[model samples]
Target: MSSVGGGEECTVTEQQLLPPPPVPRTKMGCSWLFSLRTLAAGFSLILAVLFFHPSLHSFLVGSTDPNNPFLYVRNFHVWTRRHPQKAQDLSMGSRSALAATHFQSKQTYIIIHGFLGSSTDGWILSLKDALLNREDCNVISVNWSAGSTTAEYFLIQPRVRTVGAEVGQFLSFLEDTAGLYTYQVHVIGHSLGAHAAGFVGKTLNGTLPRITGLDPAGLSFHQADSADRLHHSDAVFVDVIHTHGCYTFLKMWEDCFGIDENLGDADFWPNGGERQPACEDGGDGATSVKDGSSCDHGMAYVLYIESIKYMPSSTHFLARQCPSWKHYNNRSCPCGHPVQYMGFNADPRAHGVFYLNTSRTAPYGLLDSDCSAGAFSLVQIIGLMMLSILLVLLLLLVGLVLIQQYFGLPILARVRARLYMEDLVWHGLGKSPSTHILNSDKAVDT
Candidate 1:
């Protein structure tokens, strides 16, 4: 009886040790579902924070004060030939004195730098140097760094109009106080600054002389109206360089730069307007600046700077008028009369789109000399050599056939007879009749 009780106790203990029957699958599934739900919620929370952060920051710290110089006109500085290094600050109210002193009636070049750029950008300064070196003109480098230096493109985009209005006001002041005229003014701008230049031109009483837009920023301005963005009607003559204009898949940053549409009277599309030579690589457009991989966006200013530098050079930077890049590459487009040049030398009279090829490096201008002439010449030489060789081969073949037909058969028959006689003599076998007769005579003599 005691042994039976011990067995029962052991059985109970083993049953306990053997784990309770597996939990129901439904219960286990519910636990897993709960865990997944928690994870999803956490992920959603993170996404929400990321999405709202910029807006929240803008709402909290954005400037509201009307008198703030950084937000308005005080930040725009004018750099001329006389004061290349030192910038003359022209506010809305107090520009008459500065204009009288520095403004000239000659051609006035107002250069406005793009987003995250200042009057001191290398390209701007280089352009100023180039312009001053060539002609006696007033090259004013508009410094709106305070408005342009923001990381948020949206924040800075709206401020462009304010900067442009200030530029217009300054131009008006120059016109009233100094001897400056609207016709003498030439506004050159890059990216966002291009639109600002357009605004400046629009605000003037009459159209300005010209406006050269270097890869005008497409972001907010791409779909914007003529009054808001750069347009051909903004100036008497508007010229645009479209460097990085095509929409790139998976590259949202690139889409925000460079206007793809034809906003100017003459639009120059160099190398099909996207992925410039030597700049076909990786670059996050916002973070990686000036590393040349952004060459597609930066090439416009680079070409412009070179154009200004080499303006006086004899080589005419020729371009072919093409309906599209396909025609340009296919060589279907002819170099027509009333030749047009790209960049600063671009003829105002030249209407419609122009296409051209450029070297990847500096001195980007290509000479009017035909690019395909060398290739064509090489092909011609090769063709001529091939034709000469083919002719020679044909002549040799004809000569051999002629020799076979005229003389080879007779020679072959003579050689075969001589061989037969030699064989007969050597083998002491059957001989020709003449040889046999001769042998017979020899035997008789013997």
Candidate 2:
């Protein structure tokens, strides 16, 4: 070897070590990320659906089960002067059983109670007695208490139509068997029962002579279509008593335990149809009188009962036609306006909205026009305005907080990041590859 010149220019092998090949992206990782994004999206979609369609919640998860056969059974307890304490059961399926009882062919009055109430409630019994004393007519108490009392309010609401249908069928049976005219029938209902009575008139082809709704329920039926809830067209004469017509907390609009809309031929609004004096908060702003807020709701039937019991001396409950309660309070109502009784003696011939005042205690009817009870002080008006504004702001703040919380989730963050990368890629693909590469390099460098 010519090793004499270069000291062991020995063979040295230089092996260039290339970096280990990048670990191939795992399918499991990509799949897990995709699944998480899909799950979050699906959950948000479901929440959105429920937020928009509220009735579906009542229909899908109602308080009463439609499959239960017991829900269909409705009992009509018939009482008269001949059988005052003892009520004979009248069934839709049976004819002879009802005929053998003390069923009369006189003016028949049907009394129906609301949610969580029974045919045997103290008020119901008292009403039955009062009606019997007033005349020798038949007093029928509808007993759907089994179905109406056991379920949640929303659950029982839809079943009111069923109750109405059953009562209508029974009335038809009376028409065929007892030879009774539809005009001779008068239906009186309280709260949810009032709407049920409306359905009854609908079932009878709007032939019922009278329908009296005592504080008809407002929750589900407030915005309902005319055909679905109590309406003036449901009967020849419909009289509505709005005692608790507007909930206090919801004063921005009329929403209450009792329906606020004038759904009858004669709409009687007592004490401005919002809160009763007897049910108002005491000076402490914490204590309520009598049955609390329910005092107002119950006053409708109480006033009706008084009208029936003291018919001769019941002129005190008389109401005057006015455009609004404010006008009535101001005594600015035009002279020669129509006037009507507020309760049981409400004349079918008289029509339009009516307003009246009542005492703060039982025997509540006022002797004269006293709109003093409805006048609002300047302080009260300012307080109410402030409260409404505060409530609106609170609701908006809560909504924003919820939205921020929802979007701040780690999964949501991952989804957003992935979407952003996809967006970049999509727009990049729209441009020339060289331009994209240049822009990306510039971004990395910056």
Candidate 3:
């Protein structure tokens, strides 16, 4: 307090001299971070349901009924050298389909696609084009998408068998009606379609000349009996290309989306039959999440396509009859072991679990290496270590950001409160915590 000469009094307190306190902080709640995470998780779950629900249904509810009315061959798009760009749609056992084809004793190829696949897929189209380029052969692209896809995926297996039977019946009809030989046909299938091809062979008493299984699906078929899946005995010559091999969750390092077992007379494991070079790293045990598992699975047909396209070139993939990829890596296979060409030109006589290496991109085949095991170079190892470390750091940083968003940056709050409290307490001065300054300061400390 102070008195002036004119008897006027004026007063000023320490509180008034202090700066105004900060506004109380609002409690953090779920924000954009939470919504984003929830959205991502929901999307991933939906994808998993769509991809695995059918397989899960098959596994839990076994398919005992072989005759499913819903499953049937929708159409067979027949193509020849004359009609390479366009396909002539044909119906099963229809004389029109047989007559439309320019089949003059040329090789007949039946291309089948897997679950949720159509005859118009890129690989199927490329394969059809290649086959036409190779010779004046009869190329039939089977569109059984209806049977291959359903709301209840569990029915796919039985439906696949039904479609296969229908295809078999159609071939038999061609045999009787158009003088075509069923034994001269070459059946090629991918994933579920591979097993359909097997059923086709089974219907004909295992008389088809060849059946190629491209990265056959492993979900429900991995442990299936020979009769239930594509088997070596399904055809006279069955060559399987295993780009993505299946491994249990415990063996996540050997991750893939396709069956790894030897289900054919000749089983070729390119890039160790598991991970491919072009896919994302699986160091975090998230092969499906990180890599999408497409590169490995799709590489099967890519290799086959190249095999057909580069038939005359030395860049074609050559494989060795080794017990396993490790043996091939160590060059431990017996000297007397036979060398085999993989893909479209695979020799029927060379039958075994063959292993080989491939490049990272297009033109995947190596020129001439006894066994390029695809071992990581020193630079690659260093790069992989850096990637792993970076991945860990990135995960940690994300965790911190989420925490800050929810908890209001606990570390920073604590530091600011300590400094403010120390300034007041050390100066031998204290204010009511209810004051705007103390409330705002304590909110951070709390």
Candidate 4:
């Protein structure tokens, strides 16, 4: 019995120690799966690189050094009609040159461009020409392309506050050394630059005369507090033009460019504030940002340029205060109220939302010959009254037909007979000959 037990244990140990048979290897299937995974990983990496290129490049090459004012703040290239061909580099350190320069005590117009813009842009030059043509004011085109031209909008946003401080300091230097006053300074900014101008005004403690925000930027600042954005208190008078303010649930790339809030004393919403005439839709916000299809966003400055070109003329581009675009379209608001002109001629005292219609092409102003003329004419009123009366009579006839249908035609017949008898009695007419014959026949039958 001891020998048998030992033999069984030895057999079990041998079976446990024996090696298993080799499994079949599917090299082709394994290689195919591995190749597919490698290809998918490579594609995903490429997409990630493409998507993060802008931010990465901004981080690498963007001016993050706070001490280097030249890269961030001193890049402002000042341009005037006197030197339209050249630009003057103004910085905090260079006080002697600015003091001896062509800046006078006259109204100084500072034009600041939005994201990815330059001082030599065609619109800037055009605006400079228009302003110089109209008045003898000093036009300074604030060019901070060093900070503004970055592909990453987020990277450039922080630099705007610094640029504004630099600009405010520069304005102060002008007051101290160049004989320019804050009241004489009018800063006109488009898009992101508009908020930068607000920063400048805030830095100056709201002493600046006026700040014209041409569609102040909506992204990163739309829902920001008043301290962070362009508020009416930023300057003595603030006027805003909402040309590309898009309010929708799904904000496309191009749609989120301009703020819809009224950040100024007077807010002008031209053509309902989103779609402007003559501006073909540029697909979406991303496409517009890439292809420069920001016609609506740029229209604010265009309208402003036109206004400057034709100043002090109350006839062109007349705008009236309205509760909404609906009221403007319906022409329900009485025209007898005092009118305010949009753009450069906008009254500083004008306080509220103003509405106006513009043409699809250039010279966009709608001419108003008479301010007191009512929207509806006498003939229109009479026609409307007649149509209303006809509608009421038709409704009454329909009601009567419905009643007769529901209550039976016999009831209607009886009502008509009773009405006829009443009319005869009221007229004092005796019974007809037919009735008398019928009565005699009845008496003979009886």
Candidate 5:
């Protein structure tokens, strides 16, 4: 039989030996991809919704049983009934508080709550009580559709202008009225509120001014250039007090809050503030520490009352605007520790000496929180600083070690093994039958 020619058509068996072509790749469509992305986004939304309403977390997850669907339907109704705000009163306050104030002059505090915080939650009543007691300070609590109460959210140009306008009106009111005291426009925010204060201070630049960042939030994010991150020159002194959990964490207070600059002879921190472990009765009713310390974010009111150190000048104290003090040649709080800015004309900066280094201390403070022993604790302060530095260093070393082990060591080991195996192969070349067999095969092919 004639064999198949070299370049000619294959025999019947040859055609059968060849594999069939792969099925044509389905021409892809955007529908499934689009649907997948949509599903992912929807899932993210669900997570957000669940976080917003933690109470409904368990009920929302579907169960396998047939009756579970009906059960969930019934439970959904029950959930709506139980938590009125979730179902009822949902968007009631969107624009409701927008114009709630009687006049535009009422300065808005816009207390931005911290992480996992709401206006109603986290020192709302206490903060309100403190500000309200001061009749001089007009307040408005800002609540947003999104829960993030950071300065990034609340201190936008629009909000800044709105707040500035309100403060301007209030300033006008103070000026127009005969008996009304002069209002310099201020804000006292805790944690995230501190960031909001910084944002507003930056936004206002000149008019809407004065912010007291009580322990200031986002310390870690802005530790290197805390002042730059919180550019609040508008306010007199961003009177900062480090007493919260974040402050003491890894010396964040010293690193971020400029406690070093403002501590003013207080080598230690929480000068005149409460000590945590010492506050055995705990934060419950123990508003202030026994040795008479201030805990949590107690800057303006708490520090001033206990006769803590007043900021040296505008260089450091953001809440207390010093240029105004210098330009006006007004010693608003010249001699008073934790100087109190009664109205516009106040200067306790030059007025007071560092309480830790000074003998002068008063019985009461600017705000409601106690200020008995408003001196920085040397032991606690020193320990925190050292601890924070050590922790940061330790973390850096650990990262380096991990890099060496996970990335460097494996590559080095592989290279060493390769070199060793190569040397062995080269040395054993004469003894290898496979190499000989390969040489013979090559000779035959040639």
Candidate 6:
């Protein structure tokens, strides 16, 4: 209180001097403290949390296990039926789906067909067979609104949720039932089917998804609008087979809205982006995606499965393991030994040739954003710690502004705010908690 020379005294309420008590101190049975010592302890806890549970609580939350990616995933199936109503939801009848079920390596496939397509469309069988023949994959040729409409149109129409839902179920089967933990799963879709593949890859829950859209359906009504929903924009192995652009290289390159714009990868385009008038113009009205016989939309999968040989990295394109199983500079198998491709055929369509070439390997982890497990997880945990610490500090400083509002010891509340209640309580109750105080002056005698 201040006294005026004119004989008037100014009185100040204790309320204005302190802030509110912290919640940690108010809990009925919980102990709270407000002192420099407690702050030191709280700081120590932050370090301990980071050091102890680095995998779960630290930044490594979604980290990948390089030695064994299969640890958390289950095997993925190729062809399976969903609830009947599920098909109708997307205005699509369950065109029969067929996928080869075999896993020689960690590779898996989720293949899709185009509009008005059935399991029999271009290279459908060959693609499945080729992928299955590999020691790595279990290929699934998903059937979703095969011919109903352009993905741009149907993806937005409320009914597409049916396809989305079924795709979600398929992914669940891999995670929950199949135990597809450690291996890599690749997705392949042609045209609208390609979009569906994108959706499946985008919607996958736990493990990151790898996708290869074979001549992705034209238009962005769906891909761009529902980007985060399905397409990661940066997904790995997102290939687009431009057999549709064979003849009119310029046209294919110019069609920004359809075949040309979304090839997803540069090297895999028609003619390797080189012009081939003979193949494109051989048939009348040929070299256009809509033209059926000119090897437009129909032949993409055909060439993919039947002809195109791959560079070692192209295994990602077919959602299959490279026959040789060698990755990155022909590194030997983990046992410090090399795996042989007895029937390694470089000819992609030769089925069992020695050497061949096609698409390039996808940028690592492009398909699944979380595939960089260790790095991503580390970042996540660090972020969480920062958030937790920031909250603790906020509570302490803010609590000081309103300390007198509660009946508890105000200074004790401030100290407790600096210490995360979890760490404090876990360490056990304080000694002589009954001596806790309100202010620096009040604590001196305690």
The lDDT per prediction is 0.73, 0.76, 0.75, 0.74, 0.39, 0.42
CA error at residue 18 for candidate 6, angstroms: 99
**Can you write out model 6's per-residue Cα lDDT over 86-172, one digit (the tens) per residue?**
121111111232112322234656665555555444356556656555544455555442243233444333333334445556555
* Model 5 error, position 151 (Å): 17
Question: Which number leads on lDDT?
Answer: 2
Compose the digit string of candidate 4's lDDT tens values, residues 6-92. 565323566677798788869998999999999999999987775567644433454443533544443455656676667676655
**Per the 3 Å backbone cut-off, how many clashing residue pairs does candidate 4 have?**
2
Assess candidate 5 and give its TM-score to the true structure.
Answer: 0.38
lDDT of 2 by residue, 1-446 (tens): 23547576544333434556679979999999999999999999987775545444333433243432234444678888999998888766566777778576789998888877777677788788888898889999888853433446766788889888778888888988888789899999998899999999999989999999999988878679998899999999999999888744455223468877899999999888877775664322122212232667787877788778655234578787889999989987632223367887777877898888877666677765443323455777788999999999999867766776877634444456557666767887536675567568647745
Q: Which has the better TM-score: candidate 1, or candidate 3?
A: 1
Across 352-374, the per-residue lDDT of candidate 1 in tens digits comes to 89888876554567775663322
Q: Compute each candidate's TM-score over C-alphas.
A: 0.63, 0.63, 0.63, 0.66, 0.38, 0.39
Candidate 5: which stretches are off by over 4 Å? 1-100, 104-110, 145-183, 206-209, 226-228, 245-269, 272-446
Error of 2 at 443 (Å): 99
Q: Evaluate model 5: give its lDDT.
A: 0.39
Mark the regions of model 3 whose C-alpha exceeds 4 Å error after superposition: 1-70, 147-152, 249-255, 281-293, 312-315, 334-338, 371-446
Clash-forming residue pairs, model 1: none
Q: Specify the poorest-scoring 10-residue window by lDDT in model 3.
A: 283-292
How does candidate 4 score on lDDT?
A: 0.74
- Candidate 5 at residue 87, lDDT? 19
Clashes of 5: 36
**Which scores greater on TM-score, model 1 or model 5?**
1
